[model samples]
Target: MAARLPALRHRDFRALWIGSACSSISLWTLLLGNAWIVYKLSDSSLWVGVSTFASMSPYLVAPLGGMVADRAERRILVRVTRLATFGVTITLTLLALANVIEVWMVVSLAFVQGIIRSVEIPSDQALLANVVPISDLGNAVALTSTTQHGSRAAGPLLAGPLLATIGVEGAYGISALFALLAFASVRRVSVSSRGGVTRLRDVGENMREGMVYIGRTPEVAAIFILVFAHCSLTMSFDAMLPGFAETRLHSPSGGFTIMTFGVGVGALVGTFVLAMTTGARRGPLLLGTALASGISPMLMAGSHHVPHAAVGAILMGSSQAMFMALSAVLLQEVVPDHIRGRVMSLYLMSAGGVMAFMNLGFGAMADRTGAPILFFLPGAAFVVITLASIATGPYLRRIYRTGTAVAVAPAA
Candidate 1:
């Protein structure tokens, strides 16, 4: 336990972690509120996907966000984004209290929120790496990933009861409070290195340089491709959980909470395991767990009982966290500090932007073909992709073979 939590000893990293956790909590709450409200308003599964898409579309421009992360003062950037989130939540609360909230209004606000997220995602990630040393990066990444998936687990649980009693307006009101907490916590982070100093006029040149860097690095490029494929095919299916809960489980608002709870618990377990795992040789662990994650969806698709689905969620959540957490660690270790923000932005683009479109498509398909088929197809594809990548990508294998591949930066 002590070894896994070395990063906490650093004051700046500790502050950043708490702030990030609050941010994660707020983000998850916002997602739950949006999903439930949209589902209730339209009574159509497609609208749920559309609302998610509206909130995630900013991922498409994540490179620009990465550019800002690399060049701008990341601490201020994060605080500003949290304030934007606070504004969104407070406004939604007001509209809900007024009883004038419409479906279009919800979708429009979500779109605006997505724009803010594009900047927040990259800045937060970059700032995390900036605060921690190279040796503790893995633990830091695992813990941060926990903050996200763990919040997903807790957010809906809180939302379910709130929805049952005070309704969506009450939920948004709580989310507003969380957003304020996030803003306060982030204001405490103080990093020695703010990031690269680049002018706005050089934005085009900086972007081109970032692109060329990825193009020249095969191992890094492979990781990005895997990240994109993993998100678009496997992860995006999560957006359909509300529909699955209603149609498959036949449960009310509480169903989403149950499903997400299973995922969150599984992810927390995964974080613990990864945090304990030191040194390199994480290649097999990453690939093997991802394979398990992809295959678990089969169980989820076939589940008729709530417990069965929960078990599947646990398996999927743990494996998925291993895959993503390792990817974040490797990206941080391998990429130079100057371009790390831009590089990580590409990752966000895959995991966020591409996944948003996939959700939209999956939502439309679920309406026609049903959720079971949607789940099964993606699960099968995810398995196939992991297997194919392992067999063919010799470069990736070579990178993992060197047990201590973590690169150390020179002391300031």
Candidate 2:
């Protein structure tokens, strides 16, 4: 079992894994709580989009966050920022329990958390690279994502009970508890850098360097483009799910919880399978997952019941998890350590930015055209783009066929 899951053998990686799992669970639950509250308050899909948008809009400054990670002790930054978030979340929980919380307050809290995430995310990514050797990075990435996607099931699973019984305020309280756990869990991570204060150089130059390097590296550019398109068109459906659950499925919070939790279960199962493979030479599998990612949403488009929609959610989760992990492993293998944090930040920024803004548009579109169109159209566009990537780029096609586009992860 250790051989199959090499990353878990590392003590530090285990700590980071636990922290990330808790953090992800907190995020998904808080997001569900926030979106549900917004929907109840405004009764509009567009407002739900705004609530979701607040959760990721801070990625607009991802480069700065990246620079911070590169210049500082990545784990320390993550812990410190996580602590700050814990303080804020606790206060918010108190407010919610007092029955004084409002829609704007929830959205505003999400934005604050999002801003912190813009910094903490890159730090965690960089820190993982530091803790695990390159030979294990692929498995490490896969496993880390496993926690993220898998814990989504836990998040929404917890949310359903909490929301049904104690209300969204109770959801906020549980989310805060997770935040505190995230802060405590990372205390064991050893620092690797002297930190930003000592290594500090010209911030503007560093930021520009990260961008210029991506522009110069065609493979990285292509990957970022693909991630952006995939996230914006196919995966940025959090905003539309409210309308989809309430209007289309007619089950409200129950359907919403099932859909989100199913994604987590499928993602957990899919990425865990990939992690157990013991190598990165699975490009054909990656292509298949990417295609499945698009097709899954299309399946959701026709679903009229909870069970059917749950199946689609599972497929979407599994496919997206594999595709994302494979792409991340490939990028990590190629990018040098000097700028790893910056590049990783920008890479996620590519996904987050588009997803953030487009969520607003998706919400409005879901309102005007019905939630089903939101599902069908983005899936169709993603399929067209995925096919176009194969048609237009011989290099990309080769990666798919050989699975050797990146250095193979070592078999333990």
Candidate 3:
């Protein structure tokens, strides 16, 4: 197994992977907890969107976070950032237990969580490369991305039962517990990645260098565009899940948990398969899954029963998760270590930052036109984009044929 999964051969990477899995649980639970709390308080899907927006908008500042990651001791940054996450979750738990948690308060706390995540993610991504040898970097990244994203389904699934049984306060408290566990796991990692000292004044130049590097690398740039569109169109729909649950599925028990679980199950399978698979067929798999990503949402939009919605959710989750993890793996392979954190920040911005605003837009539209069109239109547009790319975009087509990240940039 160690030979098969090379990244798992490293003790620190193993520990870090376990730590990140726990952190994924906490972050996802917090997101769903905040969404449910905000929805309950305001009874408005729009405000639920606001909650998502607040939590993810911090990715806009992630480049600064990336700068910090590159300059500081990355191991310490991972430990400290996750520790701060525990603190934030505990505060939410305390406030909710007091019965004083308002929608505004939830939104505000989510923003704080977002800020911590902005710093946490870049450090985490940059740190992944340090723990494993270059030979294992691809598997390390695939596994990390899978754990961070594919396992995210566990969050909403965990929250579903907790929210049903113990209330959002209990959910928040459990999330904090997991966050603390995550902190503990990562604290045991020994490596300290301290690059050259980069002062605050040099941030602009550093940022520009990262941007320039990306511009020069067309493969990375294309993946960035694809990830941005995926997040904005498909991933942003999470904020609308409450409405999607209550109105569309018509499940008597409020099918939010079940729906998310289905998505989680599919995502787990999708990402795990990609992570575990060997070379060849990856290009076809990536392209096929991306195309399916569009179709799945339309299935959800057209669903008339819980079972149908679950099937759609499963498909949606699998397709989207596969595409995200593969794209991340591609980026990791091609990027040089010097600017890895900065480039990764832009990737975060594409996913989280773009989702933040798109959530707001989707939420507003959900109230006006209901969730069907919200799902259908984006799925349709993405389908069109996919077809166009296949037809004319030779770079993307080459990626589809070779199953590798082409055009690796030179070291700075």
Best by TM-score: 3
Task: Score each candidate by Cα lDDT.
Answer: 0.80, 0.83, 0.85
Backbone Cα, N, C clashes tallied per candidate: 0, 0, 0
Q: Which should have the higher lDDT, number 1 or number 2?
A: 2
TM-score for every candidate vs. truth?
0.95, 0.95, 0.97
lDDT of 2 by residue, 329-404 (tens): 7777777677778888898789887889999899988889998888888898888888898999765777777664
lDDT tens readout by residue for model 1, 18-97: 88878877877778888888888888789988998998888899889888898888989999999999999999999989
- Per-residue CA lDDT of model 3 for 1-412, tens digit only, reads 6676899989999999999999998998888788778877786789999999999999998998888887888999999999999999999999989999999889998999999999999989998989999888878887887787765678766777788878899789879989999999998899878643378579778888788888888877888888888888877887788877877777522577767777778888888778786555678887998899988998889987888888988999899988988888888888887788888988998899999999998988898899889999999888888878889888778788887777877534
RMSD of 1: 2.5
Per lDDT, what order, best first? 3, 2, 1
User: Candidate 2 — worst ten consecutive residues by lDDT sum?
Assistant: 403-412
In TM-score terms, candidate 3 sits at 0.97
